[model samples]
Target: MEPFTIYEQQMQRKLTRWGIRLQKEPNLLERASKSIQNRINQVIPDKIHTTITATVKGIVQTTLFGITYMPKTDPLRGVSMADRDAKAEELLSLYKKIAAAEGAGTGAGGILLGLADFPILIGIKLKFLFELAHVYGYSTHDYRERLFILYVFQLAFSSAKKKPELLHTIKNWPAISQTFPPAADVMKQVNWLQLQQEYRDTIDFRKMLQLIPGIGAVVGAWANFGLLEELGVAGMNCYRMRNLQDKAAELADK
Candidate 1:
């Protein structure tokens, strides 16, 4: 096995700490916020709620199951971890810029354009995850692997109260993924309302600012940049955990 570089060691420590933090129960303020958010969701019209749910469901299915949406990068087979991470960093930087631009464009256009950012941003994030999977040498072509991507998304955007369970599932993904139904069945069973609610709650404050007339452009750009940055970190560490676990298992076998 290759010896861990100082950077790798530090990253491992940071990821470990993050995992611990993720497993902790939500505090009072977080619970209160979640309650408020849930109430807000309830007051939203049923038709609008259904539309959001359907949109999110469609996006998730298309992103994960679409055959034509092959990853841009080839799988990083035989690549060193350092090289893989370097490539991921480059991809993250590129996507952040793209997201910022998209946000700015929509934000400057007022409420209607601001609303359009939802699906566009979802596509960008899902595409980024697919590309990130390839960089980590994972085949996004597999249904189970794509499911892992969804789990990572959930981990990133879920409420604090929901994080522990999602984090646990992601941490034990290899086993948990096996329990999932077939792709079609899984899609049918997806809780789209929950998914959209959690996602909307997570970004509501910043995204609402993007709907404002005067400062919308700046807020949109900044919000999208930050959201992508968060996803980048989450994606990196999720793959890192899987890679490290696989390596350790291989070493144990030897």
Candidate 2:
């Protein structure tokens, strides 16, 4: 099968596994994914000669055996020069290939991003369900930030070649679905200590979590998910990947 078809099939399995249903309407996640790809492509310098320049001038005779030469030049549009444009175009094309390579390297994470707001967006639809979990005396932690984090983590971690079991954990979710706390339960006092502690602890865990090779994506996804909640998903996905790409590049250099 063609690569795109294979990707589609794999993506479908992931969405289905997460219990996120894809609709016939415009695919926001797909659009966001493309946007990320575009942003990633921007980091690469498309041309090298664009930075260099040369100028020419005339010479004036000062004395019998002495002459002074001066150079006067008009600046040309960098891209207008043949050498610059050719180098830039070639570099830009190569950069695109590199972006594709990095993207291919990020397996499940790519799928999750493509799914867009799978967990969080779907969570909005299932708000009642999460609230129900809390009202019935379940720990609200999982449904709130924890669950949100889990979903984002799924997005980030999913992109690695060595897929994490967490994806599978969330996939066959029924086994631990009830472990999530409900809204009412979260509002209660009995479980405050544990959840509060967990909340505080997760802050640090997030830092450590993001450093892991495959785990960076999960942490990133969770961060994005939280940002989406704070700032709409569209806004969250908008500028975040550029920051991520830079960080990744910096790390690669180290």
Candidate 3:
């Protein structure tokens, strides 16, 4: 009956629908495409696969764990969910523009710059996630929190086949994460091969177009902008599910 209660209801419905969508089986076209990709991957040299896996793992680990690159952000303590959501929208708007600009710049430079966009775009996305985590009042200073950020990143960008399991894990992250004690090496838990392959498979088609000399700029900007848009929605909704579900559980206890 109350305004806050109604808002929570809306969020609950949204999260439920999103959960259902995440569980969708990959469609026919997707399966076919994946088959083709897999065939291609099988033919690629093992050394090349190893190199790519190593490169992606290095980039993620460096960006995620490097204290120097960590954004100086603090939790938005004691804020109402509505206020936090509004602030998150503002932050996402800023990041979207930054991504678009970077995409355009690199795309205009042709193949070399386009090739360079992988790490650069990933850096922007990671930075945005750090800021987003703070917006939702979560501190990334803890190992699990950084792991949470990575999970959210994968949720938004990983292959469709991986989505259902990822969604389930994220939904139960508070409990699932605890199985790993503080001393456990977070990096060791990650499936680095899955991480790199799914991420590459997810974005390869559109991102590859950005390497073209002529249309590269336009494609780059569009693709980068869309990436943020998807991530923005996922980030906000994932946080809402966690926050709202926790609050509900607390009320139930009371």
Best by TM-score: 1
* Per-model TM values vs. the true structure: 0.94, 0.19, 0.93
TM-score: model 2 vs. ground truth? 0.19
Across residues 1-254, which tens digit of lDDT does each residue of candidate 1 receive? 66556766777898889999888888888888888888988898999889888899888888667964568666888776778889999999999999999999999999999999998998888888999999999998888988888888888998987888888887888888889888888887778889998899999889999999999999999999999998998899999888877776777777
Residue-pair clashes per prediction, in order, are 0, 13, 0
lDDT of 2 by residue, 161-250 (tens): 212433444343444546656644533322323322222222323333444566555554554334223222211221122223333456
Q: RMSD, each candidate, Å?
A: 1.6, 27.8, 2.1
Error of 1 at 208 (Å): 0.7
**Top candidate when judged by lDDT against the true structure:** 1
- How do the residues 1-254 of candidate 3 rate in per-residue lDDT, one tens digit apiece? 12346777888888899889889998899999898878877887989678878888887787556774466867778777888889999999999999999999999999989978888888888888888888888887876777788889999988788888889988998889788755247677789888888887878788989998899999999989999999999999989888886686777777
Ten-residue segment with the worst summed lDDT in candidate 1?
1-10
Model 1 residue 138 distance off true place after TM-score fit, in angstroms: 0.4
As a TM-score, model 3 comes out at 0.93
lDDT (0-100) at residue 64 of candidate 1?
A: 63
Q: Which portions of model 1 show Cα errors greater than 4 Å? A: 1-7
lDDT of 1: 0.87
